[model samples]
Target chain A: MAAAEAAGLIAVGAGLAVGLTGLGAGIAEGNVGAAAVGAITEDASLFGKAMIFMVLPETIVIFGLVISILAIFVM
Target chain B: MFKRSVRKGNYAYTVTRVKAKKSHLLREEDYDKMIQMSVPEISRYISEAGYQKEMADLAGKYEGMELLEHATYQNMANVFNSILGASQGELATMVSAYLEKWDIWNLKVILRGKSYGLTGNGIKEDLVPAGKIDEAALDKLISLESIDDILNEYSRMGKVKFPADVISDYKESGNLGVIEDYLDKLHYQRLLDSISPYTQPTKIFLDYIRRDIDVVNLRTIMKLKSEGIYGEKVMKYYIPGGMQIDSKFAQLLANAETVSAAAGDMSRLDVFEEYIKPVLDFDNYDNKAVVSAIKKYQEDQAKKMAHMYPLSVLPVIDFMVHKETEVRNIRVVARGVNSGLGRETIKGLLVI
Candidate 1:
């Protein structure tokens, strides 16, 4: 492949990786976040625990972001 | 019809709100404290607790059993309505559908009161305002002269089904039992229609409804058997859609001579085997005793379903059940205290 074409392909792959993972994370967080809010509404003590659960799925997107950065810089 | 609308509901927030509300429900210790207090003290305690709004609303108008019962039901309606408001999308629909039972209950209260020559205002006090029907409509229904008038009003309102001829026949026959049975059947049938078991959450919800139907059927069989009446006559009362006891199994259970035998017939089902078996050995099958045992079992199963499906409609349903139980318990305590019944006896009557 031409050098420019290869770089374009890598950019496309990085965007896809981050975009898909971000979508997945949004879906996961939507459910957990709603539940967390509900829990916290009932018992304020649950706020800390709910926060942890609500953010747990966010790691997926973070990892994707890392992959995108590596593709742009390290590649 | 409901299958197409099976979008993800706002579960987590709703469930959390329900849990918070659930935790505030009067505990066993609260009941214990309540049992020992005078009727006034009990009322005061309730007013101080989660029932302040209901108590405040009805303040100075009533007292004792009447006041407590009215407050209890009002609190139930308020809590349920608020939950319905908080829930959005499909959960809101399901919760609203489930709340129709309150409408059915309120209608029955009206019918029963009217049959006894109660005035519209008398019946109005007992109505629970939790369902889709507005207070004005309920008032209009209560004031109507006959069951036919109420039926016409409901029909005019739309989407509510009432078999005019059959109900008229029931009224002519002076058989409120048959009419009530017909209404209950229709309510359950409508509930069944509104729920489609295509999705996992709805499947679980369907199962919960079926299990409730099963318990109701089992109670009917046990009650009939205890009364020494049996055979095909009992089949008329058997409700459809029970997961454990279909019409066939209900028939066999109806045929069983004793409560133990009827329970034995049901022992194959995990639910029956767990809750019913332990309570089957009571020496005399006081209908109340048998009913209480089944009620306890049903409550346990409701709690289990809620825990298992924390994000489904189960938690809200469970909260409703617990709220109903709490209302009943409060009534029992009020009556027990008034009648000078002992604490333990009153405690024995409570399901919590």
Candidate 2:
């Protein structure tokens, strides 16, 4: 019973690490995406530059995913 | 009671779009090149540059200075209207309110046109319908026979109500100055009332408005002082709510003996020390120079605020100011070139 309860808590922690970081990344990317689209609409040459900015925040979510994988499998 | 929802505006999108448009405004080199060109060549240059549609549409109807004037005004209206269209929620409210000055300008034109017995089309050509008042409403107002009729129609539109006594005062005095002053004051009053200075962006916006009021007040004082008119009469044209020029400060400036004395007194204030005072010094107080210096200072302040708060309404406002300056500079160059003014004279007139 003790071991089962500890496993359940660990699962919740892993879930939260991924879920909260994903939400944060979504918010950060939303603003950048809006600004990027605006710039691209004005000048087509900016598409490459805007695309880079649009994906910059996505690395945060990757970090969170790594932590969650380690928590679930490596633990 | 129901809770009021907080309004959110698309700041990121609007600011980026505005900055993009701002980048396309004419640079100093463009003006230098324009100053050397003749009127027709200048017109062609601007046509090639962002004003292609307006120039093409108005080309057959007008020529030379007239063409430049109409095209620039049309482009201004289109650009301002586009900005208003792009903005939403709180941003929309603020931008629309700011552009109401054009409404006042249109009203002044219509009233002056009616009083001068100008034909409807003649008056229509001068009006820039970029305000809350649509082109159709302006057309309807222009078709009205008398000034009183126009005022009544405007008030009936449920936007802003003109004081009943304004018409009576105008009839009694036969001067449009009274009505114009009232309209100017009304514009500022409405602007102040519309803004709530609660958040950081809003607080900065309010500060900008106050500074604008101060600039207007200082201009009036300087103009009147240059004309040797002062004392109690000066207070009549005074606009309240300036950041620095309060009623007491204005009274003090009014009591100063000469224009240089007034400039000296103003120099004590931080804002005046840098750009305005040196121009208004005893040796060089030409009205045109003073006006241009003040404009340069105003543009710098706007640019500073826009840089400081990139995601706020300041960027939009900054773009509007720059767009107006571009139109004005182009007009000055066109008129000067056509009139055979010296290049130095025309360049001096430009704010670039």
Best by DockQ: 2
> Taking the tens digit of each residue's C-alpha lDDT, what string does model 2 give over B1-352?
0122125677888889899999899999999999999999999999888999999999899988999999999999998988888887788888888899999999999999999999999999999988878899999999999777888887775277778787678889999888888888888888877777877887888888888888888888888888888988888788888888889999999888678778667876556877776666566558777888888878888887888778888899999999999999999999999999999999988898
TM-scores for all candidates: the values are 0.88, 0.93
In model 1, the runs with Cα more than 4 Å from the true position are A36-62, B1-6, B156-158, B256-274, B277-283
lDDT of 1: 0.82
CA error at residue B226 for candidate 2, angstroms: 2.6
- Measured with C-alpha atoms, the lDDT of residue A45 in candidate 2 is 100
Predicted candidate 2 versus true structure: per-residue lDDT over A1-75, tens digit per residue: 998998898899888888998998988887798799889878989999999999999988888889988988988
DockQ value of candidate 1:
0.69
